[model samples]
Target: MIREGVMNQAQKLLAGLKIPALQAPMFLISGPEMVINACKSGIVGSFPTPNARTPEILDQWMAEITEQLSSAQNPAPWAVNLIVHPSYPRLEADLQVILKYKPPIVITALGSPKNVVEAIHSYGGVVLADVVNTTYAKKAASAGVDGLVLISAGAGGHTGYLSPFVFVNEVRQWWDGAIVLGGGISTGKNVFAARAMGADAAYLGTRFIPTKEALCVDEYKQMIVEASSDDIVTSDAITGVKANWLRQSLLNAGLDPDNMTAKGKIDFASNGADNKRWKDIWAAGQGVSASESVSDVSSIVNLLAREYVSAASELTQTLKPGNRE
Candidate 1:
């Protein structure tokens, strides 16, 4: 009965996204402006709760996004990303902020979200657990999470090793619940492809990094424009987890891109490595290849919508009138 309840709640929350897409909450990239504008464009917008410098700022960001959405003629719900890991000393504190605001959706990553699922559900909020493989997917589903975010290989941050084609099908084999796929999903074609592959929605990040609403520096945006799939390097040196980052950022920090090592386990409470961290050296997905320059959130979403319609129309023509794939 609890699973059934969560399943309905997950679908209800996601249904608010008119375009069937949700922006991925990237570290140091997602912020209030980004989330607000994206929601205004009829898609789910989101930011990690930890992105705020302090608890006060986190509260302010949540309030601003909520107020703006409430006043809009037609707006989609927003989401918050919570690091459920213990090393994050602010996890409990951030959860309190979420409880106060009760954002429509909460996405948990990096640790067990069992307790978080219960707390969020108590307030009628939806919880989506982030997983890289079937092992984590089964565990999260058993914990009563409303949905699962399949972070396959080519994803920007702390990526999974399996391909999306393999991982999505494998997860669907066992769970019939809501599943959103994330990896190198950048284009409108990719968004349509995700739905065709049995995903409820596409989780996108790298493509949004170059938007004006993002909080990153100018150079970071340019680097993303200059990057391609080959320029990305997966290494655990920065965050103590194997994440995809720009190869040039590592070279800029004076580290041998091929031979890098971490001196200690990562502390989620603080910025990654003391000397070189995400602030300087950045992380992005293989999807950067599709990104060319910076633009506003509205324009970007408009472009994706046009592309999605065109691609869907093209795909529709391939099948016979009365036949299904």
Candidate 2:
């Protein structure tokens, strides 16, 4: 039986949808338009705090989204991402803004603080912390987070390097809360696979970069459409944190993919906050190779939903007793 808290949170998350798929909050790619589109498509949409240049701007964005959605009948719920890292400097201030808006969900990344979780909880907001491994997952769970996003291998921007199979299974063994499996989950079949591996939802990022609502540059979106899994490179040279990136972007920036080295220091001050080192260094997961076209968010969602249903039906048919004959 599902725990009461987990069941309540899951019901809230999956209220307008049949399956669990969240549009992962991409560092620079996710924006108000993208979030709005995702929510309209019956999925949870999110944007990181840093995506807003200032606290006032953040408030404006939130107000606009809230007003627009409220006017629409049966509007889907939305989320905002908070970078809990100490280096962020403005985390406290951003948290205040989040409290004012009180989004239905708040996704915490990089680190988790007891006070932050408490503040969000005080407002009846659910906290979903992103973790790259079992250790972080346990730590986040211990902090009383409502859910955990498992950032497994091949994920874009500050990613983890473990397979979903190993990562999700280990977390499920101890925690019964809402768990979202991240990484190379671009297609609907991948979403089914995540559920099969005991994940409550699939966190998708790279695939949405090609969507029309995303804030990615035209060139970047085209690159994702043209590239394949083999074109992705994982390294810490750009952000001082291990993340998957497009190899073509590296080559275009005059760097050799095979000779890339770690920056040797952890700079949590945003990917290219200072001098724009990561501006040209495009981040992408191994799943980009599967994205063959640029489509609107609705089209992408519809196609994935159809694919998911078809795959599930095929699996059920195969499981029937007479099918074996």
Residue-by-residue lDDT tens digits, candidate 1, 1-325:
2243444667766666667789989888999999999899988898988789788999999999989999997888889999898888888889999999999899999987898988899898989899998999999999998789999999998898898889888988878778889999998889889988978889999999988898999888889999999999988877788899899988998877788776336678664442248887889999997888888888888888888898999988987878855
Per-model TM-score on C-alpha atoms: 0.94, 0.94
| Model 2, span 1-52: residue lDDT tens | 3454546474457535545788889877888888888888877889998788
Q: How far in Å is the alpha carbon of 309 misplaced in model 2?
A: 1.0
- lDDT against the true structure, each candidate: 0.86, 0.83
Candidate 1, residue 322: the lDDT equals 82
Q: Which lDDT value does model 1 have at 242?
A: 81
lDDT of 2: 0.83
Clashing pairs in 1: none
Q: Give the Cα RMSD of candidate 1.
A: 2.4
| Model 1 regions more than 4 Å off | 1-7, 261-264, 272-276, 322-325
Q: Pick the candidate with the highest TM-score.
A: 1
User: Clashing residue pairs in candidate 2, if any?
Assistant: 228-289
